[model samples]
Target: MIMQSLRGRLFLGLTAVIVLAGGLGGLLTYQWAFDEAIEMQDSVLIQIGSVLQHGAQSAPAETPLAGVDSDAEVVIRELGTAPRGAVADRQLWGFADGLRTDSLQGRPVRLLLRSRPDGSRFAVAQQTAIRNEIAGELAFRALVPIAALIPCLMLVTALVINRSFQPVKRLAAKLNARQADDLDKLPVENAPRELHPFIASINGLLERIRLMVDQQRRFIADAAHELRTPITALSLQAENLEQLLLSDDGRARLASLRTGMSRTKHLLEQLLALARYEMGRPGKSPLVSLDQVAKDVVAELLPEAVERGVDLGFEIIEPSWVRAELVALAAMIRNLLDNALRFTPRGGHIDLGIYRQGEAAVLQIEDSGPGIAPADMARIFEPFYRGGRPSGDGSGLGLSIVKRIVENLGGTIAIENIQGAGLSGLRVTVELHHECDARATGRQQAPAAVPAES
Candidate 1:
């Protein structure tokens, strides 16, 4: 069967208890009344016997007892068989049949009698209407109090149960009134202690959802702002190319248009990559080596470094291993290295180092370029936030993508300017949780990195 709501269910349970109690109480009351009636009847019988015994002893000896009814005469005759001075037999069998017969017929009677020396009996019989009257009155008196209390008991039980359920009802109403965006923590004061943990867990989930929604909104706004300039540049360049035929500057305009298109494509690709990094795939992370990732990134950028006459170097600080998605780790390292290469002056030097620090594996990239100003350091990791409009050749999403990847791997990334180390470039550091010996040995065989496109 379909279950009822909380209020109805509680009412039903309490009503059942009340009904059971009422039934039991009624049964008990009936039993008590029945017992009292039996006791009263027996007491009346005993009193009648005592009165007859006393009358038999006190009656005048010479006069015949007149006005004795047939039932009383029979009892007196039986009593006359007893010795005069002996105690009367208290056994009720002799008169029990007559008493039951009289009671059934609604003819109540009492007798006083004694036996004479000649085996005859004298007796006086009286109608006992008062006995029946008292019994009826006592039954009415006993039942009246109990009958009055039943409704009162039920009313009191209902009130107590209703008061006890008030908190649950209030909680339900409060929840029902809430809106979808209402992610604030619930007010738990005066709430049932049993429901507190459930409320707390709901609040936690809502907080996470709110944070994610806020992040998505920010990402969209920043992506639009970043794409706007490149798109506008491409559009204007196309228009200029269209008019170049009249000015005999078609070839130059075509080159500029091509450059604009390239920039637009690069920005779009970066946006897609950042989106993919944020929407991470669910699975077990593949085994990856920090040393191999560093090597691949350095090898991919070697040609550019050579053309610029800049020295690019990689050092393995610790022969350790990590578990991560290889493609994601490569992208993360490539972005950081690409950023360094784009900004560093020709003939400058760049160093990539991988090492273990405590329980973490670390990657440090230091480039000999113009260092970031202290004021602009914090915003450098923000998506599409270029520092002071430097060369437009680089999409500002590089460091942001790097940060995102590091975070996805359960790692942290930080940047700071190197001081007094014969280099003025920015130093970027990434830290990842490393596997211990048992897990590391199981995946000791290194997988080859996918070679980067030329």
Candidate 2:
């Protein structure tokens, strides 16, 4: 079960073909060179034999080149017509004048026999093994170029294949870097011709998805707006009914009805916020003091914290400024505090912090409540995802709204369960890039915390 990458498969197939062709061509080349070398050696033997027959009368009875070296092993000797010599020499005298293979001493040799006008027979011979060794060396030399060429061909092929696939890699990088709401058409002007069809298909799919998302946002926003009027009217009517006298049981039921209506109204409000932040774009952000925003949000929510007997205050505050919308930033902070208040039990505490670290402005919120379940952590930011332990009259859209606002401002939010040191709760931390110095704005510094009355 090997994963077949296109590039890998192409390289392997081409390399195999190159090796096969080189091997076959090399085999043919070696055989041809070997045969030619053997023939050239045979021609040398005939020349020597001719020289011996013409110069025999002037020279000694035997040639001085006999067993001179391993390479020049030619032997020359004259024999009378009566065949008076060793068994091997006598055997050669019986043969006709031409080239022939015979055994001399105990090893095989190639012989060229001839006769003069005097009727004396002579022979010139060399060992067969020495001739073959010379031929093999010549043939091997002919194969060096082909042996070197195969690897060079394979290397060039690899480089070409890699260069050709660069466009695909660039396309993937562009897609990966895009924001979630980026639905603009991709540019095809500079892309390769082979990728034009693929780019067009992707652009078409993006257009369709953008349209569907627009429709969904419109439906949610429109429905919430339409329902607000009736919900307000009903709440006023229920308040007016308090003027009439009622039994204890009836009063209890009326209280429940009011709670239900309140919850419904909160849910509708959250839905409208989510739709607005999701579909609308942030344009021309201005610098705002992050600590000031946190203080304002905490001041507004202090009365509710006091009513519930919860200690809610800023643990640390520093002057930090960020570029973002004032309204959106306040909403983000308010939603986080509201979520913390809903889960924190009476006598429990909530701590808020705002500070600067390097080029980033950090906002952190920690609450003393039951920590999130391991299973629910993955979907905590999803819309209407109430955790395993649903608490209070929560609409389950607080975190979703906060997340949308955070992302709209080009910031990041991380949520994790607080553990160790005998503490257990949820901590949310957000980091935003700093814009400018807070002291340069000439605004008055606000207090870190506004405690509710006892």
| Candidate that scores best on lDDT | 2
User: lDDT tens string, model 1, 1-454?
Assistant: 2136665676677767766776677667766776686456645444544554554454443232344323322232243443353333222213432334233124555544434345445443344554445555666567676677767776776687678778777877887898654656877776789778877887788789878876885586478567767677776767676765545476676777778677876777677677767655478787777777678667778998898878889755566577777777888888888878877888888888888899999999999988788888879888888887366688888888788788778899989988995659889999998776735356753455554321
Q: Write the per-residue lDDT of candidate 2 for residues 1-454, one digit (tens) a residue.
A: 1227888988888889999999999999999999998898898888777776786352344664643454766667677666986887788888889998877778888888888777888887778888788889989999999999999999999999899899999999999999878998999998999999999999999999999999999899899988988998989988887778988898888889888998888888888888878885647777778899898888899999999898999999998888777777888898888888888899999999998888899999999988799899999989999989988788888889889888888889999999999898889999999765656766433445432211
TM-score for all models, in order of appearance = 0.49, 0.75
Which regions in candidate 1 have their CA more than 4 angstroms from the true location? 1-248, 438-454
Q: Give the TM-score of candidate 2.
A: 0.75
Off by over 4 Å in 2: 1-5, 46-200, 203-207, 244-250, 420-424, 438-454
Q: Pick the candidate with the highest TM-score.
A: 2
Q: How close is each model in CA RMSD to the real structure?
A: 13.4, 5.9
Query: Candidate 1: which pairs clash?
Result: 80-115
